[model samples]
Target: MKIGLYFGTFNPIHIGHLTIANHLAEHSDLDQVWFVVTPQSPFKKKSTLLDDHQRLEMVYRATKDYTKLRPSDIEFGLKQPNYTIDTLTYLEEKFPEYEFSLIMGEDNLKSFHKWKNYELILNNHNIYVYPRLSKGKIETQFNDHPKIHHVDAPIMELSSTFIRKSIKAGKNIRPMLPEHVWEYVDEMNFYK
Candidate 1:
């Protein structure tokens, strides 16, 4: 089995996120796209993040109907300050029969070198990168890696930060998220 881990904060799961997962699952060789809900991301500020379990629940509710898409709290069980390298190592050992690959955006690709043990991650795992508004060509810089492939995952111009701001401003985020997710967000006061 081949699995692509799509790790993110997912403060509230949105339609844009689901579109990309569906796109990858339907078009790529990957059998499933696991939304690895991070307990905390090393790169992003913790203050900007919501509670991990809450975010995971939102993800679960949003993806409940799609078997190819699932939510995970794998990082909660890992050491503090989750690192992609460490998670990859743990997953590889625990699920030896399944091949794991990373799914990320081109925006993240620019800072790829900053990750812990980036060289090991590059050598051992395959990466599927999607486009973002970020500039520059990823292939020009990372094309040397044998296990890397660029994907065009459907993305909205909007981001989680923007969505939060919209909610705070009493703006409608109807297009930014699916109905169920919006209902959950309103009910739980997430991003409030």
Candidate 2:
């Protein structure tokens, strides 16, 4: 199976995340898109960040209805402050028959060269980049790189930070999240 890994903290999974993942799954050659819920970095703990399991639950609720989308908690067990290269390597070993690719925003692609062992990652897996409104010049080396594919997906400017802040401000951000996720957040009183 060809899988696209969409990694994020997903403090609270929202529509923007679902739109991009679903679009990639339906429009691209990928067989499925996995929302890889990233665990919080032990070194840089943020007060607003939910527990790893809580974030994963939100992801699961957001993606439960989509056949081509699912949630993954692979990074929860890994060491803190894990690198993409390390996760890719671990997934590759765990699922030898499956081809894994990365799903990232254009902004991340701009700084892709600075990632650890980026050359090795480029050589091993494909990178599917979606559009994002951000300021940065992409590395010249990646402009025409075969391993990197710039997918013409819809631009998603909504962010978890914005949602969290909105909730804290007593704004009805219910429309931003999946029904189950919204219920979960409401019940838990998260980000309030």
The C-alpha RMSD in Å for every predicted model, in order, reads 1.6, 1.8
- The candidate that achieves the highest lDDT relative to the unseen native structure: 2
lDDT of 1: 0.84
With a 3 Å backbone cut-off (N, CA, C), the pairs that clash in candidate 2 are none
TM-score of each: 0.92, 0.94
lDDT of 2 by residue, 98-139 (tens): 999999988788778889899999999999999887665455
Q: Residue pairs in steric clash, candidate 1?
A: none
After superposition of all CA atoms, the RMSD between model 2 and the true structure is: 1.8
> What do the candidate models score in CA lDDT, each in turn?
0.84, 0.90
